[model samples]
Target chain A: MTQEVEMKEAQAPPSNSFSSASTPSTLQHLKEIASLIETGAYAKEVRRIVRAVRLTIMLRRKLKAATALAFINFALVQGSEAHAKLSAYLPKEDEHDMDVDTASSASQGFAKHALPEIEIYCYLLVLIFLIDQKRYDEAKACSSASIARLKNINRRTVDVLASRLYFYYSYSHELTNSLDEIRGNLLALHRMATLRRDELGQETLLNLLLRNYLHYNLYDQAEKLRSKAPRFEAHSNQQFCRYLFYLGKIRTIQLEYTDAKESLLQAARKAPVAARGFRIQCNKWAVIVRLLLGEIPERTVFMQKGMQKALTPYFELTNAVRIGDLELFKTVAEKFSSTFSSDRTNNLIVRLRHNVIRTGLRNISISYSRISLSDVAKKLRLDSSNPVADAESIVAKAIRDGAIDATIDHASRWMLSKETGDIYSTNEPQIAFHSRIAFCLNMHNEAVKALRFPPNSHKEKESAEKRRERQQQEQELAKHIAEDDDDDF
Target chain B: MDPRLVEVTQIFGRFKASLLRNDFVTSSNLLSQLKVLLTKFPSLPPSFQRTANAYEELQIAREIYEHAVLLSVKTEDQDAFERDFFQLKPFYADLKGLIPLSPQEYPILGLNLLRLLVQNRIAEFHTELELLSSDALENPCIKHAVELEQSFMEGAYNRVLSARQTVPHETYVYFMDLLAKTVRDEIAGCSEKAYDYLSIADAKTVLMFSSDQDLSNYVTEEHPEWEIKNGCVFFQKAKDSQPCKEIPSLHLINQTLSYARELERIV
Candidate 1:
């Protein structure tokens, strides 16, 4: 209960009051966090430590060079190696305005050996500072040193801060374009985190490794590792969202468009609303995968708030696909070729060419019950020397893939589309209804499984004899009070 | 200093010398012997045991397997290429810092890629391509195979057929020839459906066949249904194909109605 009180002290009003105050009060809050960590470590309650780390996130944006210098001077012993290194990382002139309290705190709490949690926290602070400062090379060096220090410390209290450190470690290496340099190191760290049963560390490192692999278009390796990694309930929403995004990308590249669409849509839905950029990426991919699967996504997807401008090219691309215009698709692809390549989705767009042909063939077969091969080729706008032949094969493949119901007449060079039947007369609706029911049942089962009961509530029940005894005691007290009143009279 | 390394090193040297002399039989024997000796090296993959000279052992073993892959190419033995390429993959994937980059890496990797394309194993081709670094994807050898794959998927047979003339390395010729056959077959499958008949000379040009004999031989072996009459290829039309079965609408409607009733009752 005391630790819970400490947790509230760090969590409840800091972020809300953060905007209600100025820089001095923010620095004051930063100083209070040091004491919180000290008490947390002394009491061996990790939740307090976790709360201290959470508070740093709220203060992260308001941090300046002088605040970092003063915080470092107060957190570590004055003139220690870490203090000197951290102070040197800040600008030299920012220390001119340190308040009296920070200076007194620096003099007061200069312990010879800071706790491991505090050490990792300082590393997190400096790393976030350097990365925000755009000093990636320095950030890389700092993160490497942090990771080395992290490996020697095995305290469970340090796990939360260590996970944050691992995140910045991979982020800095990625910024330096030297992720290849630390692939083996990251793997070793992941193994260590697994052995320690640090679920958050495992989740963060697994996502980082996937991002690393997918950075170089290594879908095969990413899939192999993802399948073999230990599965557990997610400990962090943000990391799980990232994991889903990478999985969607791998599935997209591997031609599993249905599964890819599900993952990408889930990722977009589960992402925090503030993460507009990530949501836009997920939506863009979901649209393309749906297009490839022969399903045009809803219009509101492209018109999503804050996503309209970035998704305009995809909207135009989707329009071209919807109409089954090969020429328009070609132009749209050419116009946004740079954007697609930058997104590393040009390979997926290249695959979309077949989908374009299939869409064109489906439209043509629907409108024309009987058409010559050359006419079909002309309608599709196939640009090859043998357009008729290419059109024939495109139609053949589409037919074989169930894109259309058409038969080719080789002797007369005509495609004879079969008469369209009413879809409602088929078992399609039955199957669709059955699937919906199954989906509802599955969701109910999942919700039931997710329902959590309060711990030991069943033990709160009272025995009948205890209730009767309590009632008798109440009557006796009432009678004694009445007898005392009569005696006073 | 390890005797197993010394023995593997000597056999690898002999393999290279025999390969250069074009004595394939002797080089083949040397390659097999070198592979067996490499298994004894503690530093190789699936073991990765560190020795005093682990780097040297790994480098030599990699070279021997690289040569063996190219040898399979030279010998036009597809099975051996697959086996040797798999054995050599760990060296490229595992030993990045141990040894300097091999000059033969891109060409051989590209060759394996082209082989996959020829076999129409597109998924594996992509998987292999993914393992390469971004810089490697820019190599002309890899770029050539990638463009060929793109063209193949786009059904641009003319470009695919023309790509054979611009082979980046000599070893690519064999796979390019096989890929050309695949492209021609793809085109053949399409043309027979599109045209009622084409002149013999037109079919020759369309299939990229050099002579009437090759055209007739292909038609006879691959599509016996296609008849050559009046100096033109007359493809078999839809006469022999099975008619489409009609959907039983009444039965389907009954099933759907029953399902709706059951759903209504449950609700």
Candidate 2:
């Protein structure tokens, strides 16, 4: 132990680090995190421990093999199992780095002992490194081991890291297309999280379960599990966003386009600006849902920053639907069939065919006072042997659905269009006014949501304390691993 | 095997024999008895209570539920079939690793999908379809139901009608026939609106009726509004005698004015 202290003293300078040393700042930041976790464990302040986990996100990106190896050896015990397993996943050098191993975690009570938080953090670090190296098989093995380790731990300080581990565990399994193998395991973990009241873990695992079920197209089971899982205030915005997105997808499949649109839009709005891919996905689904609901999405939705290229196909789809041209819709559907399938929007697009016909019929009704069913069918490009019959039925259904103000004159085989009414004189303007008011009220409520605080909880003198606490919470959100979902593999 | 498991197995065997023999009354009674007796074994789902012969007990219980689902199908009891299928689902879905794959699993799941399609429970049908693995989807029974759903959504009623003859399993035959009826009815509805009048022969072709008797029965019994005269079926559409109901513009304006006044007061 005395020899360890001497060794620590010798290596405590600004420069003399392990061979192939990373930047001094990275080493310094890691040391700060180790100290932070120490202080958090000593004081039993889970917030600080969570904050340390947040700081580790920055450390994760710059974590070279040597840097991670050095940090693990520094933070873990000399011969601990976690230390051995983690470094094994990293590429080792020809020369042994045993000289760096002398830095014991528990020495002279100066540099604190190994906390479970640090160990899980090391596991997270190494898991990320393996995934970055495209060693999914190794990453899968590492994450499962870490999850097993996480199960025995029930501390709130460990919840953040454990939640991250649960995510990576599911991600690794998903990357291997063996997600079904872990369904029971994820369900068990979800149960454990619920019993422990680990809200963050519960949230992440719930989203993972939903993703797992949706991956297989198991909407009934996914809906069942989601409905049965315990509901609580979300502990993380990223997880909440993921939950909303999945919920939107399930609703879309169930043909609840209104609810799907609301949730999908909310998810896009709530997602961090950096999560471009997630936002793009949300927008895509929202656009489709809106189109399915027969409400055209604004051009601005397709013109959002950084989403143009990804959304071009949807934009073209919307254009086809808007034009109400059957041939154009078919061509567009055929052209982007692969993209739609990969996005799982192919099924939703199939349902849009009816909407395309309705729109085309509406446009035709507006332009023509009276037209024969055969001529309408010819215009709509109904390429059937009995275009007149197809057009008659299509027009009747469109009229019944209130897509157009027209009556089917079956006796004459014509669709007689009604003159367009004055919108301002009708109740349409009143309903429009009511909707605008509702929107204003909703915006006001959301603003209040952002501005409200618990009554009488603010102490004037400790306002700084409250501000610091809030800042720490924001910092927790500041470096989310959720952004990786948007990263191109 | 435990004595309790042996009892369940015996009763399950009797239930299966009676169910196959078309004796639903006796089989249902035996099934109820087996359920009550099986509860005594603490090895079923949810708790999966451990015992010496837990695996054997769970396996037997699963088999019993599988038999119960088949019995419900044989009896044509939709409610009972739904209940039994749900009870059997945990065995295939959750406890899959604990037991070997059953041959009946895919066939039963496909039947459930077909039933949902027949019931017009498209939403539930999709939810259930999402649960299947790639291999399960590749099964002929599941693939048959999946293709039918695709054709149904794409408005290929002719394909849906033709699919009736090509059902993959015997149990599927019942749902496929029901599906064919549904498709014919849908086509009938669309045909009445699309055509002012159709010849009796054309009506038969449009509705996929093999005989004129069936078409006449459908027209006379179901659609009494249809008039068959001069050998042509005439759909008597209701004439629009009442003018289009104008939107209650005055009331809506009043409400809108009140809202604006309220807004002014708040401001």
Best by TM-score: 1
Sliding window of 10 residues with minimal summed lDDT for model 2 chain A:
A1-10
Number of the top-ranking candidate, with lDDT as the measure = 1
Evaluated on chain B only, what are the TM-scores of all the candidate structures, in order? 0.89, 0.86
Q: Distance (Å) between predicted and true CA of A273, model 2?
A: 2.3
lDDT over C-alpha atoms for residue A237 of model 1: 75
The digit string of per-residue lDDT tens for model 2 on A1-489 reads: 012123223323423433344444575678788888777877878777777766765555555666677677677876888878887887765453542343333233345367898888889888877766558899999999998898888788788778888887888887777999899999999999999988988999999999998887788879999999999998778789889999999998898889999999999998877676678889999999999999899999999998899999999999999999889999999999889877777767877887887788788888999998889988888775566765765675565445777766655678888877655654566567788887886686677669967676745666788879867767655545453332211
Candidate 1 is graded, for docking, as incorrect
Encode model 2's per-residue lDDT on B1-267: one tens digit a residue.
567777777888888788889898999999999989977888787777777787788788888888888887777888998999988888888777777888888899999999999999999887777677657878999989988886575454665766777888887777777787888777777666545688888778767789989989998888999999998898876653343358777877787796677567557
- Among these predictions, the greatest DockQ belongs to 2
- Per-residue lDDT, model 2, residue B98, is 79
Model 2: CA > 4 A from native? A1-21, A90-109, A376-391, A453-489, B1-74, B84-110, B131-267
DockQ of each: 0.22, 0.24
- Per-candidate local distance difference test: 0.79, 0.78
After TM-score superposition, the amount by which residue A451's alpha carbon in candidate 1 deviates from its true location, in angstroms, is 3.0
